[model samples]
Target chain A: MATIRDLARRCGVSVATVSRVFNNPDAVTRETREAVLRAAALLGYTPSAPARTLATKRSRMVGLAWDTGHRGPGWRHPFLQELLVGLKTALSERGYHLLMLATGEDADGHLRAVRRHSLDGVVFIDDGTADPALTRLAESGVPCVSLDRPVTGRRATYVTSDNAGGAGAAVRHLYERGRRRIATIAGPGRTHPGAERLAGYRAALAALGLPLRDEYVVEGDFYLGGGHAAMRRLLALDECPDAVFAAGDEMAVGAVRAALEAGLDVPGDVAVAGFDDIEPASLVRPALTTVAQDRAGFGAAVAAALISMIDDPDAAAPPPTVLPVRLVVRETSGPPRAG
Target chain B: MATIRDLARRCGVSVATVSRVFNNPDAVTRETREAVLRAAALLGYTPSAPARTLATKRSRMVGLAWDTGHRGPGWRHPFLQELLVGLKTALSERGYHLLMLATGEDADGHLRAVRRHSLDGVVFIDDGTADPALTRLAESGVPCVSLDRPVTGRRATYVTSDNAGGAGAAVRHLYERGRRRIATIAGPGRTHPGAERLAGYRAALAALGLPLRDEYVVEGDFYLGGGHAAMRRLLALDECPDAVFAAGDEMAVGAVRAALEAGLDVPGDVAVAGFDDIEPASLVRPALTTVAQDRAGFGAAVAAALISMIDDPDAAAPPPTVLPVRLVVRETSGPPRAG
Candidate 1:
C-alpha cells in the first residue's frame, strides 16, 4: 500500500516526477523512470485502477448489452456461445473484460446499466433499428457497435454476417439438387437477419426460374417449434415440397424431427437445409446441410469495431462489415432425388 | 455532475454533513437528510461509483471466473447456458451485474483480474480443486462461491448437484429394465462430477448384486466425440454391453449415434441413458433417458450463497448446498430387449 509520495521519497524525486513516470513515462527521463520503477517494485506500490479511471476518465472495460426479455425460438441456439467465445478472446487480447448487461424488464435498462458503470465502450447484439435507447447512448458520446441489427441515424458501427447471401446459397443448393417443389421456413420479418434471409429465399427462387408458391412458404419464429409446426403445414399440402430450407439451424433440426416422426426418411423424402452451422446441426441424426457463418469472425469484427471507436471517438464511422458465409453440405441435404 | 461541495453550499450545510448524509444517512437527523436530499435532487448531484467504492470499499460487482483454456468435450454443452440464465436472473434481482473474467494462458490470470477490478465478491465455476490461485483469492479475503467444483481449505461457499445420486438413479432405472450387462461412459475423473458419477455407477451395481466389469466402464470427456469413441470401443468388445449410461447428455447422444450408425436399434438392441438432461437429450432421435439436475436451481443457489457471503463475510461458513437430482425416463433407455 505504498503511495506515490512514498515512491517519490524513496526514489529521491518529486511526487510529480513519480506520477509522470507512471502515467506518461516518455515525458520523464529514462534514468528517473527507471529509479521510480525500482522504488515502486521495492515498495510493492501498485497504481489503483479506480484512481486512474477517475483521472483519465477511462475504465478499460466494455459492456455487452443484449435484450434477454424475449425467450424466442433461438433461445437455445449454440451460435451465441460461439460468438461469446470469439468476443471474449478478442476483448481479453486487448486487456478488456466483458461486463454482461442484460436489458431487464424496462426498455431503458441497458441505458441505465451503461450509465451506472463507467464503460469505455459497448457492443449491442440483436438491437433492433428502432430502439430509442441506442440513439440516447450514441448521443451520450459512448462508442458503440451493433451486431446483427443495424442502427440508423446513430454513429454506432454495424457488424453482421452475410445473411442474404448465405440464404441464397442454401436455396440455390436445394434447387441444383433438382427439387422442383421447394418450400421455405422463413424467419420473422421484423429483425434484420429474418428480413434479409427471407428476401434471399425469394430472390433465389425467382433467379432459378421457379414459381414462388405462396402455400409453400411458411413464416416461423426461427425456433424449433415454429419449424415443426411449419413443416406439419407443408406436409398437409397437395404437392409436398421435395426440399425445405429453414432460415436457422434450430428450425431445420425441428423440421427434421417432424419429418422423422411422420415416418419419412430425410433426404429420401425431403431434403433439408439450414443456416448457422451450430454444433447441434452436426450432432443431429442427418447432419444438417447449412450456411456456415463464421461466428468467431463476426464476434471479433464487432469487438474490433468497438475498440477502434473507443480509441478514436472522432474517427469517421467505418463502413458496415459483413462477414462471408459458406455452404456445408451434410447428410440432411444429399444429392438430388431421381425424377 | 454536481459535486458534494455544491450540494453542501446549496443546502446551507457543511461539506462533512453532506458527505455523511450520503455515506451514513443513519448518523444524520431526518430533517437534515430530507434537506440534503432535496438539495441534491435540485442540483442534479449523483454519487460516482468509483468515488463511493473509494469510501465504502465495496464495488457492488461480482466476478464470474471460468477455465476456457481446454477446449474439452463439454465445450459446446448446453448446461453452461442454462446455468448462466439462472445466475443472471438471480444476480439481477439482487441488483448486481456479472463481470466475466476469462482465465487466459497465465495460471494467475484470474487472480490478477480479481485484484485489478474492485469486485465485492466472486463466483468461480469448474475451477479445479488444485488451483493455488483459489487459495490465494480465499486468503485475499474476497467472498467466493464455487459452483460444480468444490474447493476445500478456502472457506469458500460450495454449491453443486447430486451427481452420485443422479447417476445411481440412472443405473437403477436400467436395472429395473432387466439389463444384465450394463456399461457406463464416465466423465474425466479429475472433475467432481466425473468422479462422483463414476462412484454412483459402481455403488449402484454393487447394490444390485451386479458385477463391476472393468471393460464395461470407459472414461470420456463429457463430450459427444468422447462418447462416440467410447461407444465404438464397446461395440468392438466380444461381449458388448446391453445398456449404456453416459455421464453427460452430449456423450449419450454420441453413443446413440454410434449404435445407429452400426445398424443397431436404440432400446431394442442397446438401451442408452445420460445425465444432465440437456435440451439435446430430448431433441435427439430416441429422446435420451437421463438424470435431470435442476440447472436453474443450482445457479440460483450459488448466486444466493455468494450474495449472502458478500452481505455478511463474518457469517459462519454455511454448509455446502447440494441440490437434488431426478431420473427423467425418455425413449432411449426403454425396457430391456426380450432375450
Candidate 2:
C-alpha cells in the first residue's frame, strides 16, 4: 500500500529524490540514498518488475515463442513434456522464468508483442516448418536461440538433434539386418530436419551400393495419418520393400499399424525403424525401433545458448548446436528370435 | 524509441499532460487526449505492460503455481503435456498468458513472489502432496483455482477428476470380471485424490458384500516403484488377491510389470486396473484398463473458473468442480475372449 510519496515523506525527501535513490543512486548523496533505501525497506515500498525493467532494460523473463498453432494444427512436439522439464529445471537454477509469448498473426506483431512484454530474450520453437515470420525474427537484433531450425542473425542460434546422422544410422541399421530393399517415410523437404534427414537417407543408400529407387521414398508430414498413407503407398509399390524407415516415430507407429492391418508380421515380413524414440515407441506392440534423441539434453542446451546470448549482447551468435542421437533396438527392427 | 518528453514536444503539450493522457485519460480534455494519442501513435510511444499494471493494478498474466520441486523429487503429473496444451489453448482464447511461478522454499514466499511478479491471479497445481504453501495460497485474496485438490477462500476454487467415482468404477469392473478378492494400491491418504479413491475402493467392496481386508489395501506414492512394491507384497500374501486397482496409471503399469515378471497373466491370473488413462495406458502390453480423465477439459475448466473469479472480485468462491471420468476397458481388465 505504500507509495513513493510515503517513502519520500517518511525520509524527509522529495519524491524525485526518492526515485533517484532507487533508479540513479549516484545522482543523490550516499547518506540520502541509504536513508531512502532504509525507509523503502521499512515501508515495504519495493519497486515493481516493470519499473525495474524500464529503469534497467532487463526483465528476468525469457520469451518462449512456439509456432505450433501456425505451422500445423495439432502438431505437438513428440517429447515436449520432457523438454519442458529440462527447460524449467535449467532456467530455474539460473533465476529466469519462461514467459511464453504469443505467436501473433505476423512477424512484426511478434516483435511488438515481445516489446510490449519487455522480455529480456526469446527461445523460439521452430516446428520444423519453413516459417517466414520465424525467419524474419531470427534476423532481428533481439537475442534468441531456436529449436530444430537454423537461422542467421547478429544474435541468433539453433539447437537440434543430429537429424542427418540419425536418419543415416536408421538406414544403415536396416541394411545391416540384411534388408537391401529398404523404403523410407520421409518428412516434408521444407523443414530443416526433413531436408537433412532425406539427404542422409539418400547418402546412406549410395554408400551401401544400393540403388536409390524413386518409388522407395514417400514424403510424409511427420504425423500418424501422413505416415499411414505414405506406408500404404509404399506397400502398394510393384516390388514391396522388405524394410521401412520413418523420419519420425509417430509415422513409424502409423506404418506399423498399416503393416499389421495388412496381416504382415512386423520384423518377420517387413522390418520397421523410426526416429525420435518417444514414449509410444516402447509401448507399442513389438516396440518400435527408433533413433533416440536426448530430449532433456536438447532443452537444457537451448536454455544455455539463450542465456549466453542474453548475458553477452556483444557475443557472436553461436553455431547450431547438434545433439547426438542413438538407435534403440526394439522388437520392430531387431533380429528375429532363434528358432 | 520516443520518450514521454518526445511525445509531449511533438504534441505541443507539457510532459505531465502526455502522462496524464495515457495514465488518467479522464483527467485530460478530449481535444488534448486526442492530440496526445495521435502523437503517441505517430511516435510509437505506447505504454508498456509494467507501466499499465502499475497504473491499473492488472496484469494479463496468470501465475501457474506448481508444487513439484517442493514435493517428491521426480514426481510428474501423468497427463501434464495435455494439461498444458489445454491450459494454453483456453488462456490464449481469453487473452491471458500463463506465468509459471516457481515454488519457493515455503508458503508465504509464494505470496511474495506473486506480488513481485504482479500476477493478476494464480493457478495452483496442488500435486496431492498436502502442501501447506498451496493451502495458504488458496486462502489468500488472490484469485486462484487449484488442480487435483481443494481449498477454502474468498476467491478460490478447484477442479479435479471424479476420483471416487472413477475408483469405484474400477473396482466394480474388476468384480464384473469375476474377481472378488481385489487388492488396491492407494496413494498417500493425506492428498485428496488418494483419499477419495481409497474411500471409493472401500465403499465398493462393502457394497458388493465383501469385507474391507486391511492387508489388501497398501499405501503407494502414486509412482511406479510404489506400485511394484505393493503388488509384490500382495502376491506374497497367503491368500493372494485375484485383482488389483492402482490409484494412478504409473503405479498400475508397475503393478502390471510386476505381475508379468511373476508369471501371472494380466486380467487372467490377476486382473488389474488404474486411474488417469494417460498415453502409456493404451500403448502398454495388454493395454492398461484405467480411468480416463478429460485432461484438456480439466485445464479449460480451471481457466474458466479462475478467469471468472478474476473478472468478478465480489463473486463468492465457486464450489469445487468435479469433472466426470469413465472406465476404459482394455486387455488388462476386460473379460476373457470366448474360445
Candidate 3:
C-alpha cells in the first residue's frame, strides 16, 4: 500500500531520483540506490507501473496471437506453447514484454486496440498469412511477424519448421521399414503445414516407386475426433494399407486406438507413424513411432528472426528459413508381416 | 524500404508531421492523414519503431518470462499457451508492446539495454517466486505479476488455479466410484501445485475415513518415465491397491501402459485416474478417467488479474481468487473388481 513518494521522502531524495534509481540505477550512485532500497524496505513499497508507463511510454509489453484450431486451448498442444517460451525468452533480454491476443475477437477491432495501445510488434503463431487479423495489422502499419506459417505476399517477416522434409522423412522411414502399402492421414487442406505435409507424402511416395493410393489418404482436422473418423475411412478401403502415417501425433494416437478397436495388433499386424512426436507419443501404449520437430530450436529461430526483422525490416532479403526434422523409430513400426 | 523522408515528401508535409500522423492520427486533420497514408502506400513506407521509442520513450513493449519447464517448448502444453493468449489479449488493448524475455537474463547487466529498450511491465508465467531473475526485477523496481503461483511476500501480484481443491475433487470422485485402497503417484514436491495435489489426496483420504497408506504413494516427476517407474514400484507391493491416481495425465498414461504390461485390464483389474485431462487422456486406449481444468478460463482469469494489477497496483485490498475445478469420470475408475 506504500507509494513511491513515501519511499522518496524517507530516503530524503526527490521522487524523480527514486524513479531514476529504479529505472536507471547506473545513472545514480550506489549509495543513493541503497538509501532508496532501505526506504522502500521500511515502507514495504512496490512502484506503480501503469502510471510509470504513461510517463515513460515503455510498457515493456509484446503481443502473442495463436489459432488453437477449433478445439479451444487443448492441453495436448505443447508445440505452440514451447514456441511461445522461445519468443518470450528472446524479448525478455532487453526488458521487452509479452501479451496475449485472444482468438475470435473482431479483426479490425483488434487492430484498433493494438494501434491505440502502441504495441511495438505483434507475433502471429501458426496463423496463415491470409488471416483477417494479419490483413488489418498490415493495413495499420504495425510491425508484425509470423511463426510456422507465412502470411503470403505480405511483406511481414516469418519463421517456420521444415514440415515438407519432416513428412517426407516419415514416409521414407515407413518405406525403409518395408512398408509398401503405406497410407497417410493428412491434415486439413487449408493449413500451411498440412498442405506442405501432404505434398511431402506425395513426393516421398512417387520417389519410392510406389503408386499413389488416393483412397488411402484422408483429411483429418488435426484433432483426436477427426483422426478417429479419418482412420475409419482408411479402414473402409478395400485394400487396407499395412502402414499409416498421420500428419500429427494426435491423429496417430487416434489411429492406434482405432486399429486396436478393430482387433489389430500395433506393429505386428499394422504399422503406425505420426509427426510432432508429442509428449504422449512415448507415453501411450505401443510407444508411437514419430517424426520429432525440434520445437525449442524452432521457437528460438522464430524469435530471433522476428527480433532481427524488428531491428531491420529492410536489412537484407529475409529468406524463409526452415529448420530440420528427424524420424524417431519406436515401437509403433516394424517389418511388414510375412505373407 | 521507403524512409519517413520520402513519405513526407510525397505527402507534401514535413517528416515530423508524418511521424505525428502515425503516432497520433487525431493530431492531424483528416485531409492531412489521408494524404500521408496515400504517400506512405506509394513509397512503401513503414515507420521505424526504435527511433520513435528513443524519441518518445514508448517502445509499446511488454516483457514475458515464460517457463519453458523441464519438457522444453513442445507447444503441446495447451494450458500454458492458452494463458499466454489471454495475457496477450489484455496487453494488446492498452496500445502496449510484448517481448519474450530469456528466463535467466539479469537486470544489472542489461540495465541500460532494458531502459534503452522500453518496457511497461513484466509478466512471469509459471515462474517460481524465488527465481533469481525475478529477484533482480524486484530489486530493479520492475512491476511484475505471476500466473499459477504467487510470488511470496507480495513482491508481485499473482493469479493461480486451485490445485488443492482440484486434486480433492478427483480423489472424492474415486471414492464415489466405490474404489477403496486407492494408490497415488504424486508429482515432484518442489512445485507448489504438486505439493498441493499431494495435500489434497491426503485430505480426501482422511475425509473418507481411510487411513493414509504410505506404501500406496509413490513419487513421480510428472512424466511417463517417472510414472512407469512409480507404477513398477506399486505393482511390486505385496498387496497393491486396486485403484491408482496419477497427479498428471502423462504419468497416468505411463501407468496405463504399465498396468497392461502386467496383464491387468484398465478399470477391470486395476482402475486408473489422472489429473489435467489432456487430449491423450481420452485418446489413449480405454479413454482415461481424469480431472479437467478449464485451461482457457484459467488463462482469462490470470490475464484479467494481471491487467487489473497493472491498472491499479496500490488498490485498497488484494483478494486471492481461486478458480473452481471439476471431475470428469471416464473409463479409468469404477467399483473394485469382484474377488
Candidate of highest TM-score: 1
lDDT of 3 by residue, B179-266 (tens): 7878899988876667878898999899999889999989997888788889989988998777888988888988988888899878
Q: Give the lDDT of residue A176 in candidate 2.
A: 93
Model 2: CA > 4 A from native: A1-47, A103-109, A175-179, A225-242, A258-270, A314-316, A337-339, B1-46, B70-73, B103-109, B152-154, B176-181, B232-243, B258-270, B312-316, B337-339
* CA deviation > 4 Å runs, candidate 1: A39-44, A71-77, A126-135, B6-45, B71-77, B127-129
Tell me how far the alpha carbon of residue B6 in candidate 1 is from the true structure, in angstroms, after superposition: 4.1
lDDT (Cα, tens digit) per residue for candidate 2, span A105-181: 44665666667777777888757775777667677788888888787788999899899999999999999988889
True contacts kept of each: 0.44, 0.56, 0.35
* Model 1 docking tier (incorrect/acceptable/medium/high): medium
Q: lDDT: which is higher, 1 or 2?
A: 2
Tell me which of candidates 2 and 3 scores higher on lDDT.
Answer: 2
* Per-model TM values vs. the true structure: 0.92, 0.84, 0.76
Q: Which residue runs of candidate 3 sit more than 4 Å off their true CA positions?
A: A1-78, A91-122, A132-144, A152-157, A307-313, B1-63, B68-78, B90-99, B107-122, B127-129, B132-145, B154-157, B310-313
Error of 1 at B288 (Å): 0.9
Error at B147, model 2, angstroms: 1.4
True contacts kept of 3: 0.35
Q: How would you encode candidate 1's per-residue C-alpha lDDT over A50-85 as one tens digit per residue?
A: 666666667777888765444442355346667777
The collision pairs in model 2 are: none
Docking class of 2: acceptable
Q: Candidate 1 vs candidate 3: which has greater TM-score? A: 1
